[model samples]
Target: MIPAINIDAALAALTDHWSPKVVARVNDQYVKVAKLKGEFVWHRHDDEDELFQVVRGRLRLQFEDGGETVLEPGELCVIPRGVMHRPVAEEECAILLVETVTTKHTGDVETPRSRSIAEQLA
Candidate 1:
């Protein structure tokens, strides 16, 4: 049975930056919690839109077209599929990510920060 999943507890269990842990699943998407800081590589999923919810601190989503969006607690944003973007957090930030189960953490450009679905599930 899927028990009640606590976001705070789920976030607290995370110990790495840019690494997402699967906390729940709704239909074809995976609900994940991650601790983030610094800057992530610029990449885009070819066919999956990615959702980010700011749970703590702040997040800056930078786009390839020189645009950006800052997210505060309780704020969420969705990056449409195929949009090149990168995530940066000046300080440690906690966030919830919702995306298809097949979505790669860093899209096609694999970096040291990339986390596989199997790794996320573990």
Candidate 2:
């Protein structure tokens, strides 16, 4: 039997900001946890939608249209495929991400904070 995952424990194991680690997988999707403290790159997934659920603190997703969505704990938002957005956190934040197995971390844009799938899995 598979063991249950403690989200808080999984989060505690993370030490890097903006780097997400794969915690679980359901069908073709991956459940990831990440810590954020600053601004992320503006990017979009061309073929896959992304789900962001705030576990702690606050997160603001800024869109290309100059609008933004702020999420607090227990709140979630879904970013549609091909929509450009950036996540910003004035304070440290913990988030849960649900995306397809093939989704890239920063879409097609490579940045210093970008992590490869292998890195995430590790």
Considering every candidate listed, which one attains the maximal TM-score?
2
Over the stretch 1-122, how does candidate 1's per-residue lDDT look in tens digits?
85799999999988889999999999999999999999999999999999999999999999999999999999999999999999999999999999999999999898887889999999
**TM accuracy, model 2:** 0.99
Q: Candidate 1 — which residues are off by over 4 angstroms?
A: none
Provide TM-scores for the models: 0.97, 0.99
Model 1: weakest 10-residue lDDT segment is 108-117
RMSD of each: 0.9, 0.5
CA lDDT for candidate 1: 0.96
**lDDT over C-alpha atoms for residue 102 of model 1:** 92
